[model samples]
Target: MRTYLEVSGGGVMRKQPYVCGLDAAVDVIDGKWKVLIIWALNHRRCRFGELRRLVPGVSEKVLAQQLRELEADGIVHRESYDVVPPKVEYSLTELGDELNTALGPLGAWGKRRMAVLEEAGQD
Candidate 1:
């Protein structure tokens, strides 16, 4: 029986045997920019420059890289239009939507923690 699943990104593929479901899930969103990218695309499809604006701190290169990784992980869909300037847009896939839903509780917890910290003058 196979114990590990295959994952690919940025033209590289590998098999990872995760100890738990959280481990597998965290692996997909390991970077700082990925979750932000997912969040930015959760509502609607966005073009590259628009994504950069929505994400605030992400550079054009990093946004493109994160989008590629998300697409490779089956969490994002990229559509291209062969217009004069060649337009492209990114949106969350079904898997990505589910992933965002799964993150709701985490977001709530973070918000609560942030509030507590603010009350304690920690931030």
Candidate 2:
């Protein structure tokens, strides 16, 4: 018989085992747009237009949807100010900062891999 150890936050054991044995973290940030949005917000807070400009190739509707989802997940915060033009801004929450920290190494790995792919004419 094989025994599996389920390790979670702070090395604590979970009472209920995962269905597929995969972490739920990935599910929260799943999809191409979500990561891109998080990456853009990782640097600083941005207005709607600024975010749309920073992430190239994303449609307005899709971007809005991604932002809403991130906001609902508590990883991103959306603030609105009563102004002439209805000012709105988006920034990473505390959870998002932690997530960003974890993703930094992955981003670095991707950068290195991309450089290699470019040299090999794959990118």
Per TM-score, the best of the predicted structures is 1
| Displacement of the residue 68 alpha carbon in candidate 2, Å | 0.6
Report the C-alpha lDDT of model 1 over 41-118, residue by residue, as the tens digit.
876999999988988998888888778888888899999998988999898999999998888888899999999999
Clashing pairs in 1: none
C-alpha lDDT (0 to 100) for residue 83 of candidate 2:
93
Sequence-dependent TM-score of model 1: 0.88
Q: What is the C-alpha RMSD of each candidate to the true structure, in Å?
A: 2.6, 7.2
Name the lDDT value of residue 25 in candidate 2: 70
Candidate 2 wrong stretches, greater than 4 Å = 1-22
The alpha-carbon deviation from the true structure for residue 115 of candidate 1, after best TM-score superposition, in angstroms, is 0.4
